[model samples]
Target: MSFIASIGQGAINLYHRIRWVVSISTAIVQLAFHPSSWTKPVRAVLTRQIVFTGYDAIGFVAVVALLTGISVVVQAQVWMGRLGQSELLGPLLVTVIVREVGPLLVNFIVIGRSATAMAAELAGMKVRHEVEVLDSQGLDPLVFLVMPRAISMALSVFGLAMLFVVFSFGSGYLCGAFLGTGPGDPGIFARSVVRGVSSYDFYNILAKTLIPGLLTGVIAANEGLSVEGVATDIPQAVTRTVVRATLAVLVVSVIVSVLTYI
Candidate 1:
């Protein structure tokens, strides 16, 4: 009977989590359609979120992209050399780096940085009864809080994903100059990479990046706003935010990839 009760509670908890995610997603869309969701204070917050999630994160994203690009390109060159498939290098880079790695890596960085912070901040506000205070003031917390974040994070992720892919392409080209056959013809390599990517591929990448970014804010907002009880609950919310957002993004990435690739 005790075990049965625990199972029932677990099922209820799962239902609530799913419901929270849906609520925040719906709130984001509704808030976007509202006029007051873009007031001066909220605009300022959105700008700050972009600065933190997009601009400030560029250094780490670039470094990771560079390393990944260099390593993957170098290794591809070596294997292709042995297999006599060196010409495929450009397509390989485009498919792997531009389409897949760029979007996933940028979102992962944002998940680690902004998602955790968002969860904790919201949780902190909740514990302090700030949300209730806002409610009493006739403020719709969803509009005042969640919408800007969703817009900023979505735009930021898309921007950062582009930056990451550009850096990855640059790094791959640089590595190709020394490691591959192209010693002094960077333009040729660039053209090759370009030819490898199709229009559908570009749209697919954008879809993947945009969805993850939007969902990330939603998941973080859900986790953060759902926090209850003591200060200890904040850490758990933060953890859930990171774990859930990352998993959600990865799942979305895979689904997008399958559809795009097919």
Candidate 2:
């Protein structure tokens, strides 16, 4: 009976957590569309969030993309050539890089780098009572804090995913050419990739990036703000932010992928 009760309690807690995150996400989406929500202060927060989460992440993301391209793209080219199915190289690369790997890896990177930082920052603010202070000053914390961050994350993830695809393809092509694994002509490689892409690929990347990014931001903010006045809880909040946000990103990715097939 004791073991059963513990399992039941854990299930209840999980349900509540999911409900809370979903409610916060819905509120964020609604506030995002309201013109009044984009006040000067909010705009500033959004801009800073974008720079911190997106612009600053470019170098690291580019390096990862390049390495991934060198490995995945070169191997695909070599194998396709071996099998005398070189023509299918473009479609296979597109399916792997654009449809699957690109968005997923970028989101994981952002979750590790930016999302953890955002959670810790907000948790610190909560411990300092800064959130209460802002609330007392007639500033809605949701508008001044959560909304902009969430919106910025969505935009940042989308931009970074696009960059990831481009960098990966460029690096892969160059590396393959140097290794004599790819076609001698650059135009042929470019055309192969372009031919592989369809309208669904665009939608797939967009959904995978923006939705997961938005949910990740919301999860970070929610976990951070859930911290009580105790300073000791801050670390725990940050940990939860990473765990929950990662799960959220994976869930969204799986759903989107399945929907694409259906």
Candidate 3:
């Protein structure tokens, strides 16, 4: 009975945590669309977050994309060629890279790199009572701290995911051509990939990136802010941010994939 009771308690805790994150995510979106929320300070913070989460991480993201393209794209091309279904290469790559891999990888990278850092930074601020300090100065912590960071995360993820798709496809094409695995003609390869894309793919990519990115940002911020002014708990908060954000991304991705089919 004790074991069952503990399981029930854990389930309840999970439910409450998810509800809180969703509620905060909705609030962040609402605040983001309000014209008055765009104060100079808020804009500055948003810029900094973008630079940190998106721009500075470009090189790393590109390298990962290049490697991924070399592996996944090249393999798809080679297999399609062997199977005498070279025509399917474009659709296969589009499905694997654009509809799935690109967004998921970019979101994971942002969560591991920027989200963890954001959580730690916020947790440190909470531990030092800086959040309270801002509150004392007539600044709402949600608007001054959370809103900009969360919005920037969503924008950054979407931008980086687009770049990932482009870079991955380009690297895959070049690698395939050099290795004699691809069609070898740039025009043919371009046309094939272009033919494979459709309007649903555009919506698929958007839903996967923006929704999960927003949820990830909210999870990180909420965990960071949940710290009770204890320095020792900051590390725990960062860990929770990573775990929760990763789960949120996966759950959102699976839901979007299902809805795309429906």
Backbone N/Cα/C clashes per model: 0, 0, 0
lDDT of residue 194 for candidate 2 = 94
Clashing pairs in 1: none
Error of 1 at 47 (Å): 0.8
Q: What lDDT would each prediction earn against the true structure?
A: 0.83, 0.93, 0.92
Candidate 1: C-alpha lDDT: 0.83
Per-residue alpha-carbon lDDT of model 3 for 83-158, expressed as tens digits? 9998988989999999999999999999999999999999999999999999999889899889888888999999
Clashing pairs in 2: none
After best superposition, candidate 1 residue 16: deviation in angstroms? 5.1
Candidate number that wins on lDDT, 2 or 3: 2
Give the better candidate number (1 or 3) by TM-score: 3
TM-score for each candidate, following the candidate numbering: 0.90, 0.97, 0.98
Residue 131 in candidate 1, Cα distance off native in Å: 1.7
Worst 10 residues of 1 by lDDT: 175-184
The per-residue C-alpha lDDT of model 3 at residue 209 equals 88
TM-score winner between 2 and 3, please give it: 3
Tell me the tens digit of each residue's lDDT in model 2 across 55-138: 999999999999999999999999999999999999999999999999999999999999999999999999999999999998
